[model samples]
Target: MTARVGVVTFPGTLDDRDTQRAVRTAGLEAVPLWHRDKDLKQVDAVILPGGFSYGDYLRAGAISRFSPVMETVIAQAKAGMPVLGICNGFQVLTETHLLPGAMLRNNHLHFICRDQKLRVENAETAWTRSYEQGQEINIPLKNIDGRYVADERVLDELEAEGRVVFRYEELNPNGSLRDIAGISNAEGNVVGLMPHPEHAVEPLIGTGRTDGLGFFTSILKRLVSA
Candidate 1:
């Protein structure tokens, strides 16, 4: 059977359709999951795409953390399901404590958007297994609250466990701590990043480069093999 990847949509979310397209582009079935829905529709994996959920009110992803869909996503992720969170979705992961870290306003306090270069710090995660460790790729990044922050101890722990999946290369667009761009759970099943990989998956869309396609393809390969 073809692997089904769920793309969740919350009110104010602006990237669900693009994310679903990215999933379908990877030869996987794209399943639409609504914020108000409690069922996952039995997807093999899930993606929380980028966008200004709840208009970033209260916090970028703070309000969406309590949405009905996240309750099951949180549990399934903890049970070893692959979950990828991008941009505002990354904020939601932090808000739900699914990933360790907090996203704050950019140090410059400005919304940053551009093609970002990232080094794959770890490639064993479900969402990044197709990339090589230390490999560099360019992905589109856009956000106001993109600065990733975590306590020193937690940062050290993540580093010690090889959970830092991606790191900013060349330029730190949002002043993320240690130039961290993305991280994964200890089990490597849950990953989150401030960059919008979905935006970079297709050529002629953002930068005419498909460097971000590996993310969607990586998870599809993992699910198919499983």
Candidate 2:
């Protein structure tokens, strides 16, 4: 069966369509899921595309955490469903407690937008298996509140468990804790990152680099083989 990947569209979401396109480009059916809908449409994997969900009011992704769809997503994710959160989506994952740490304002206190270099630190996650560990890739990152913060103990735990999936290389754009650009859960089914991988999937776009396509392809491979 062809894998059906769901791209969630929350209010104010700007990249759901791009995420869907990337999924289709990766040879998977792209299913559109709504924030008010409790059902997942039985997708094999879910992608929370980046945007100013809930207008980024009260904090980035703070209000959107209570959306009906997220309630189901949180449960399904805990049950080992594959979930990939990008940019503001990453903020939601942290707010929902699906991932560790919180996102704060960038150290520079400015919204930074650019093509960023990141090293694949742990390619064992469902969303990163297509990449080799230590492989470097360039992806676009645009956000204001993108700094990842966690207590010392939790940071150490993440390091010890090898859950740090992506690390900023060359220059840390937001001064995220330990230069962390992405991380995964212990089971490697849930992954969250601040970079906009969907934006980098098409070669004709921004940087003309398709390095981000691997994220969608990785999950398709996992779902089909399973």
With a 3 Å backbone cut-off (N, CA, C), the pairs that clash in candidate 1 are none
Error of 1 at 23 (Å): 0.4
lDDT of 1 by residue, 81-164 (tens): 999999988899999999998999999999888999999999999999889999999989988899999999999999999999
* Top-lDDT structure, candidate number: 2
TM-score of each: 0.98, 0.99
Q: CA lDDT, every prediction?
A: 0.93, 0.94
Ten contiguous residues with the weakest lDDT in model 1:
195-204
Off by over 4 Å in 2: none
